[model samples]
Target: METRSLRDDEVMKRKLLIIGWDGASFIALDGLIERGCLPTLARLRANGFSAPLNSTLPPVSAPAWTSFITGKNPGKHGIFQFYEVNPWSPKALGRGQRTHMAVPGVVVNSRSIGEAKFWELMSAAGLRLALINLPMTYPPAPINGLMITGMLTPPGARQFTYPPELAEALPPYEIDLNPREKDFSSPDAQFLRRIRDVLAKRTRVALELFRRERWDCFVVIFTETDRLQHRYWHIVDPRCDASEWAHIEADVVDVYRQLDRALAELVRLAGDEYDVLVLSDHGFGPAAIKRLNFSALAERLQLFVSTGGWERNVRRAFNRISSSKRRIYKYLTPLVPERFLHRAEAGLKTLARRGVKAKLIKLHDYIGGVWINTTEHPGGVIEPGPPYEALRTQLMNRLAAVRDPATGKPIIIDVRRREDVYHGPYTTAAPDIIFILDDEYGIETGGRSSELILRIPQKNQGTHRREGILIMSGRAVRPNVQMARANPTAPGIEDVTATMLYLADVPLPEDLDGRVIEEALDEDFLRRRPIRRCSSSRRPSPDVASEVWESAEEEAEIRERLRELGYLE
Candidate 1:
């Protein structure tokens, strides 16, 4: 009996699988490959095309991921920072308390984001897509297919957005920031083995679902490379330590090899049944640590009160004051009765209109830019006030003046308005101030935990590097694409969304800030999308600690194996 081969031209079977790895840098990739470690990745590169993937400015995960999904900049998408505004008065928002409440009339969490995300566009076009582990998608929405939230949301939070009739027949799904806790904690050898096992398992689940359910496009992510690099860069660098470095390098190589093997398996399973596209949101690299005290700079400008030990005392005092106020607010909120809350809120809004600023004192010591309340940006209650603009300029100038004592190099390399850094009409409540640290230096503002500052020993031992990689191969991907040609320097991280959407034959939303990379596709490829629709689908279960301890036991074995392999000691 002869068996038919599944091929890309089959037309009958058309789908796309996208795997997003967090912080998989081309810098790390080159090192691993030159050392003869990542054969599978190297082979894949030989068979396809790969280049440095440009990341978002500020080089963080949340904004970059959002841009990748929405094809818009932070200005357009509005998720500028990790924490949102305190929905209640500042007095009510404190540490360990959820700061922002769902403000009435605001359906989406971030006001900066525009509608027309990748899945939404695809679903509306009538194509079924499975989006697994994409970040910032918590509180999962009603989708045409599966929508498992990624890491930023708290664990075990996947709630089904589709109805029971639509969801009942789907495979059980589980999602988390990092799903393999036990294996993650294990040693090198076992960790590698566990990663392989998990990849095999995840791939199997995805394939089975694809075949049984008959979905059009599917995407699953693997973030293991990112996790390993953050903890092991010192070990892998040739210019670093001499004695123990060699052993660590071997372990790092093993991770690359494992990912390569996993890719091979995915390819085998996909078997031309779908077009495969692998990408990293941003690439990885060598980073150094540097602490900067913003309050110290503030003192130089006389904005902050500082004594010999005044900074520590001030932080403690602020924490206490903020805590006391929140507890009182929380207590009064219920006691005053439901009817009074609205009336009080209305009165407060009236007071706000009359220019009665909230009594809460903000030290203005935080590292990020403050939003200047002005007619230019509405919904803002505070402005620089009379002393504001001058004070802001003076402070920005002083921060720019800071330099490394030893090297005499400037600490802040650039300080631009958020509007200047990002381009789009959907601007954020722009930070009143913006400061960029010297490469490898983290802004360690004063009023930080004593443990964070006093405990960490080495300076310039932090992370912050440019030069991430981008790789693309599969249906209609142009061959021999070079990094310089395929990606121009300083490409907005959001461009990935437009590029992917174009590949999937989805129409570009008019408001998107990014343009599709038309040259990246083969000329003969059709841009017309296939017709498909999702009847109903269930959100995957949130990851739970398995009742079966066998996997946990296996994880323990892996950690020990890693110790011997010198990945961790």
Candidate 2:
């Protein structure tokens, strides 16, 4: 096994295909595979290396997928979540006085990503590329080959493809399943239908592109997996009552089966010449048994102080009305007029937004981060330095102490200071304190209820986990290898990009947090093509200003989509 440099012909001939199944986990996949339901994946696992890919800190899609493409952590990528706190808003001033209001600044877009994606680096290295339906890729940028943006593309956005004319060449495609059709409270046949339809359209586009595109590397992601698991986990989870959802169980499984077929088709099209890698941004699990209202808990602990004023009174009134409305809707929705109910809901939302002010600590719902209101904001109650550190420490301790009432088990698994987990110039933009909740619990930041802990309903019984699935099989990969057995630390989402770059014979970027997963590669392949490195110091700094949505309507549309997907309340 003599080491040698990859020749130009070898580099040009290397082909890699990445298929991302957002929120896929081995817990579900293994069970399905054992049942022969996902034969393609089963075959892939049997023939090649498989491992659990660790997700980002919060285990959410936005950051995890971004990390996957950039081989960087959330701090380095500058996309902590779907949204971030806007401390500079004039609304924070509130008539020249400090008010306790949380203002979500903007929906994160492609421009928000701080690092160059692997495709960009590969393109610069003279590799032909095809990127399809990759999330956080909205506002598509020019690349070496072609690109089709994925999640967060505003509904009706015309510029979802690069070169502007590629959209015309492709079949009618959707960025994602319409979020509005999701209804977790009941079995939704319509939702299932829409997902299947979307899946079909996506598969068609992917297959068509793969057939026509001439490229060294092609990457495409299917987000419907994450969407289905989020809403229909109850159908698959054995712990949930089967009687109510048993009828739809087969239909749900069929969705996965259809996905399996689609995956097989894609691989068949890729041929033996291409190295195939299938992965997920994060894993899926039973939704938490209880919800932790961070804002309520902070208030209970007195770490979050309300600036008592007329606005506070108004907020209190709004809460009472909102609570009463929920109670009424719970009992009267069947009897009430639909239009009336919709108007009432709209009115309440307006009231809630206008009446509420910021507290000392803001709970960012989408990102699952807690920001300390320091002197930088309008109503900064806590001073920067010692006070900030003390508050964070105290909050972390209190959160760690919380226990589930029914089980008497700790609810929080870990609480970390921002600095402990994140590094880079954008670190300060992150929450001062980041906490990880037990899988049995989910955090609720909307302050919809005063209770610190509320039981989760069965309908909403799935959420993200840290361990996603990764399967690598190709001529260049080792057979029958398990990543965990090969290495103590499992491969992470970030490592996927680095591994792909290495396989494509591109030099690894020096600034990347992820390293090539060498154990999964064939001994001969590694010996013949030694790894290479290049300085990425010329890349843009993470602190470079990010672009925001040009119009309020676009921002609103994205917010609604996130809310429908259960990312926001």
Candidate 3:
């Protein structure tokens, strides 16, 4: 209350509602709206200008949503991947240093994040906020108001809420999800019922919180859309269909309708006073996951690791196992430590290898291709001089040239070096090479030993596309405006944090990677309140890095949950 600088009217009028739909893309949303399935979302879009926001480099949830919340790239935020490099444990590197791979697993933590997320800043500024089920936000921190973490949370945990005792009042929250629930191939009644029940429960919890608690900035994220899209992509996706479960076509439609109803209820609860902003981390397309084997390909190029056999077997076995990727990944982590992970190809380089022999550390963001072990690590062989540059150039060419044996089309559509996309202190942690797939043609991230290796699937299922949904509608917004690509201009996920800060009449830090998406706002609104920019020197946990909160048990549990949801490898 002491930080209150606003008048009574301004305090009451400055309310912002943020709703996040994990994996919601404009492509999928437009179809649903046209068919009259998601009328609530349709109306909201009509009220405000919206566009398909460009997702982060990997287009995964952790980095994408974190970018939206922090207005920074993976390099600055240090959340490039989910399971960041955890080379800690004193003995981990024979020192006191500890770390987690920024490659993937959105930094699995059972405790609140060390970084100062936007909500934390708001809390500091004396604004009441409620964050319900936002991904990569586990162990809800103590905010000025209620806060609930999302999919990144481990279930059966009582301390998930800011109050810590909030779960005891509800009908048991469903914080975790598995892949089979959305997997239409083996669709069952119980699984479908469970998914519906879980979503309903979460919605109920959110509704109760909103009514029970007074708040200014409120955010609620629904992640089931992402889980469903990833698993049941075949059924809901217009690009593909199942003649067998053809009866369930409407079931997928019902899911969207369910969400629409929920949105309507929330909007109704908010009345006309609130400005609503709906968005998604990244768009979803048919699964074109290709588990690229940089190790096998490198070995053939005479640049293979000595431990290639062990790593390859781990990957192959993971594919063979019917269990969720969670358990299998846990089984794989202990086999190799992060320090020794940057290994050189055997025989060719014994203590010294020629050129840079690549070995993928792990496919944390499953779709993100092989992360090469280079001179970036303490044990790395690829020196940063001419040798590193020469090897990267060669590897990029070889990977980009990979072709689909069945289609004769190139498997990789683009290739990028780490330095090209990310910058900051953690820049060296990025994968040596990131290769994009030609998802349109059904090229997937296939593994070396998998049956789908170097081949397209019978039907393209789901993959993370760069374009996701971004709808802005509220009192200060223009109506019926569909964003156009007249110029090379498009808002990115990174722009969200600044936009929110702007809407709340708060000044923003200039160090942010994204600029305010001014086009989405009404002209009159902008004229009245010009954007105010500050410096990063004043901005700092939204500064948390180099911490691993989840113990081995918790990491295994959450990883399995992510695997069951098909988010991890």
Candidate 4:
């Protein structure tokens, strides 16, 4: 490709603003637009280049957002899910205490990302930036401008913002919704109120920073959209009876309405001077309610071996006792004094935890990934090479053949081996077998249940889909263009970083997996600023200042939040 280098003044002439709605999907947005609920987004779609943004293979937030910022596939960025098998140790680890073959895995964090982010590249090029609420940004790295860390930030942590002193100046800010404040599985007026409050505070802080901070690039992500969708999809989906959730239906729509207003305000603040790009990491849809016990299926297939049957029996017995306790609690709650409630609850929780003891290969609930007992881990049963490959193939075939007894249709839509789906230096860290369940079915990894599949009422009625929303609007972009016509395959989340770099006139890295979205840019802009590529990729040394969690309790707190949000089992 032809390349050019722009002058310092030329690089400073253009500015870009990226607005992220974490899991906004056109599937639901289209209906809202028609109903006149999201006028700001509707106007952007009509005036700008709009298309469905494809996400990563499993399409979960951790990998998808990492891909969006790095211009790399999950294999290259090294975050396949919210959590993966810890490759270095078999000891019990942080976050949900998830284990496989006696090895506990760690939650994905800033240190987990293997590739450099585009903003880091831009910062190196002397561009100012304001990174707000981006996931996996805890222990904020030094940037040219300012940053406020987002999801996975430890609760009550004082070091969430870069330029540490900046934290004191902003309005009261929250990194994410507090999982302790609300039961996300069921709808409550208090939960909706909290969501609105968080949105308002985040918007207030973002606007304050946008107006006060110096920047060439500004990025802010609103995670409330994804949070609301996960809990309230049943209220919004047309197929579901709205009357069933009538109490919170209007409040749910109002949240989106608030988001629409926030979008309008942000864009209005940008005015006509800045090029704007709006997108999502992945889309949202009605969750599959039928839970498939993947570990149970693996056990039945003889691919996974538990420590012993005694553990299973003990777990089942505990479950029965716990169920009976719940029934008794319902009768006693109104009669008993409130002072003793906390002690009783804590005791019950202890009893439940005592039941789950054995560690084995199992499915991950968030991403539908099956961690295999390969020779890579200590005490692994399946040997590497042909045996590993054969086991993966056998499991994939068996999973694909599984059918729903009532519908007589396959429950799993697709299955793939790790190598076939991902490629890069970090591929070895990924799950052995990844599968996609039908939209009507959800998979569970916990081996607490004896049945392979069960019809259950889920508290979280929404889940992520592959196709997200993308809109590019500004003076430099072509007006009213449909990205699908120019690019047969919709642009993936990985493309956003390259597009941002191109707009900022930074030289593209040779190893990037994305291309500049030329079809969406104006011809004059393209002609005036030709593409430039560097000879080698840049891998900066890890910053010593970007520290991990300070204590185990802090790490555990974040994991509990993820579990409450349904990201962890």
Query: TM-score, each model?
Result: 0.67, 0.85, 0.80, 0.84
The residue-by-residue lDDT of candidate 3 on 18-103, one tens digit each, is: 88888887767777789899999999888778887888877878778878777778777766655553232121212211111222
lDDT per residue for candidate 2 within 432-515, as digits (tens), equals 777777766666654445567876554465877788989999988999986652234899888888889888888988888888
Order of candidate numbers by TM-score, starting with the best? 2, 4, 3, 1
Q: How much lDDT does candidate 2 score?
A: 0.75
Model 2, residue 434: distance off in Å is 0.6
Residue 72's lDDT within candidate 3 is: 79
**What's the CA error at residue 558 for candidate 4, in Å?**
1.2
* Predicted structure 1: clash tally: 27
Query: Which model, 2 or 3, shows the larger TM-score?
Result: 2
The ten-residue window of minimal lDDT in model 1 covers 98-107
Q: Which parts of model 4 are misplaced by more than 4 Å?
A: 1-13, 86-88, 91-104, 185-187, 304-366, 483-488, 538-547
Q: Summarize candidate 4's per-residue lDDT along 460-501 as a digit string, tens digits.
A: 778788889899998888899865422457888888788889
- Candidate 1 per-residue C-alpha lDDT over 198-252 given as tens digits, one digit per residue, 9 for 90 to 100: 5555555555655545456677676565556555656554555537546655655
lDDT of each: 0.51, 0.75, 0.65, 0.75
